[model samples]
Target: MVMSANERLFYHVLIRILFVAVIAGSLISLLAEQFWVAELFTHFRLYYLLLQALLVLIFLHTGRHTLMALTILFAMPNAWVAGPYLIPVYGGQRATAKAATSIDIVALNVNYRNDGFARVAGYLRERDPDIIVIAEYTPAWRDELEFLRKSHPYQFGEVRPDPWGLAVFSRLPFMESELIDLADTDTVHARFVFAAGMMSLEVFAVHLLPPKSAVWARNRNLQLENLVDQLGASTHQRIVIGDLNLTPFSPYFSRFIERTGLQDARRVDGFHVTWPVSVFPVWIPIDHALADPEVNITSVHAGPDVGSDHFPLEIRVSKGVNKQPGQVRAVFE
Candidate 1:
């Protein structure tokens, strides 16, 4: 079939505009480190890729090979950013030592306004991860999670009314715990230490402030930088997990991972978008777990949407922690 001259012109114009938009959007992501607005643009890497892909197909259909080639060329960077997360490691090699133990951790936002206590509680009972870290924790959530006390005997955390509140319940025993509050940044985060044989392991859990404005963005970046020091002396194998409110595409995120040397869970798990599920066609991964180079991300599973705008993340981390041989710990209600 042959297109009319008018139709050809219209398609060409539309494709050109989209190609330009994609290029601008991609460039803005590069300035994420310097500008908060540019940082926001970094979150939707997949969206940019999709838009460029659509343009490429349209240009090809219209027989505009030059524009298609240019679109494809620009789309490569976006593809590189989103590709690793799209394809997860199905079954990576693991440590075969007899003492190696892997534990499943459930990280949930548990929105403050949501009153679906039973729904969230039921999912916790069903999934039954060895460790459950609750963000956006409230006073009301305290009683609701009591049932878990039996299985996860060693519990630690703070109950607050704000979104930054957090709590952790774990079946494994904790050797130490800290509520890190940086004086300058006014950011509070939870850190728990556990023993795995002679090796000490640290789990840093947090729900950083969302970059809603310039002030919040400034604090968020400060909090991210401060966390490196707040995490302290690197004497333990670290596992940093929770709702960072910043996506992997952001330059700050890349720098944090580089400076901290923690591996992102997404590299092991497929592209898991956990936020803004309430909205259609607009979602990016803000929740994440980054572990030390020696630690292993066995698997990660998405929990059912139990009333929070963000879904839950069930992650299995192994090869660093230790467990007794067939000796089970007692449960207390």
Candidate 2:
């Protein structure tokens, strides 16, 4: 059916308005990365890129010069930001030779309210990871996880009822372990020495506050900065794993990577959405496994949802020849 002149004009104007809005919105979102207040938008960079791509397709049919310009404007920033993650050329590298000294770590944020204790315990038993890091680990959750004591005899962190409760259980013996307080959260820092005693790996189980408000976001940034400082001073093969509560696309996450010199395990393995498992589109990779340059990530993948808002992340890393003997000191006050 052919449209009347009035109807055609109405659609034309509507398309123009949307086109301009898309361009403006995309630009604002891209620029918002520089500021802490706009962190909520930065968390969904992948969603923004996908939305812009959809808008481009819709604008292509309009054939208006202004719409074309807007489409280009919208596409450029999204592509530039999302290109590295989407393209295979920027993928992470695997360790050339498999070293005898390697560790398998599993990080998960089991929602404090979710009572999937049996499911979580079963998954842990099946995976049998060398190290297990849990966030939102309440006192009850600790009781449920006690069954793991036989395998993971070495445990660290507190078993509080708060959402920030953190814990780490390892089969490997700990050379040194300490619980350090960040601004409003606690982080577990431990060094595990292999049985052979020739090499060691420093493990940090971190759980930063969720950026729900401006104050929280700023505090989370501070925690990240402090963590980076601590990791930077370390002289050992390091693995920072847990519910960081910030996606890799966020400005704070980028800053953390830059300051700590840690490589994201997802870089080599591919994106594995870990949060809000109940929701598909809004899911993001808040749980992560970051390793120092000397540690090579052999494999990284998200585990099956065991009744938690966040899925578990399992990462395997090979220790490099370069080993530093000193432990990382906590800088948090």
Candidate 3:
């Protein structure tokens, strides 16, 4: 079917508007550190590039070579920024001592108000991860989790009515457990002296206030900075996972990595969005997992949805060597 003159004009106008908006957003978000609204736009760098690529294809099909050229030029900046998070990590030689182990860690945000305990619980049993971290834990959920005691016998956390409540259930025994108060958020911290053949491993579960306004944005930044300070003084082989409420595109996230020397576990093949679960196409990865540079994050992925607005995250770690190859491995296991 052929479009009338007005119909063709309308389609052209709509595409032009979308292209302009995408270009503007890509540039304005660079100042996200100075303003909260800018920070909100910063999280969508990957999405922006995706939209730009689609726009470029449309331009080429419509024989608009100039628009196609400009679109590619603007998309380069976003690609440069979001490139690291989307690509796979460098596959380097890994230590293969006899004590090496592969451990699966899971993180889930069981929305406190969600009445889908059975769904989330069932998902856990199906995955059977060695360690689990939960956000928005509650007294009611605590009782409900009793069924998991047989598999994940060790438990420690703060159960509350608020969304900030956090919990950790593990098959491995905890050497030490504590609750840290950072920027009005109670962060759940857990330690495993010798998990499998790996030596000490410490995990910190953090949830920051959504940065919808200036005050909330500042608080989130403060929480991250304080957490970094604490991490600097903590033991090695550290892992931090939770609903960070900020994406990797944010300057603050870059600072967190720079200051603490932690690597994002999102070194995957493509975008792995984990929030705003819905029928809409808009989605982002606000929930994240980070680890020390030395730890090998074999894979990080989204788990089955558990009746929440966020999908659970499963991270698999491969420590230096085979689990039972060395005498040290046998002694620890």
lDDT of 2 by residue, 153-264 (tens): 9887777676877788888888778887765445433333343235467777778888787777777888887777677666666778888888887767887876676777
Among the numbered candidates, top TM-score falls to 3
Could you arrange the candidates by TM-score from highest to lowest? 3, 1, 2
lDDT per residue as tens, model 1, 24-53: 999888788788888899898889988988
RMSD to the true structure for each prediction, in A, is: 6.9, 4.9, 5.9
Score residue 37 of candidate 1 by CA lDDT: 88
| Candidate 3: stretches off by over 4 Å | 61-65, 89-100, 184-196, 321-333
| Model 3 C-alpha lDDT per residue in residues 1-333, reported as the tens digit of each score | 999999999998999899999999988887787788998998899889989989989999989999899999989978887866555535422323222367788888888888888988899888888888888888888888887778888887788897878888888787877777776545444333335455666777877778888988888888988888778777656778889998888889888877777777676434578897788977888988887766666678777778998999888777663233212100111
Candidate 2 clash pair list = none
Residue pairs of candidate 3 with colliding backbone atoms: 98-326, 100-321
Q: What alpha-carbon RMSD in Å does predicted model 1 have with respect to the real structure?
A: 6.9
In order, candidate lDDTs are 0.78, 0.73, 0.78
List the candidates' TM-scores in order: 0.86, 0.82, 0.87
Better of 1 and 3 by lDDT: 1
Specify the poorest-scoring 10-residue window by lDDT in model 3.
Answer: 324-333
Show model 1 residue runs off by greater than 4 Å: 1-17, 89-100, 320-333
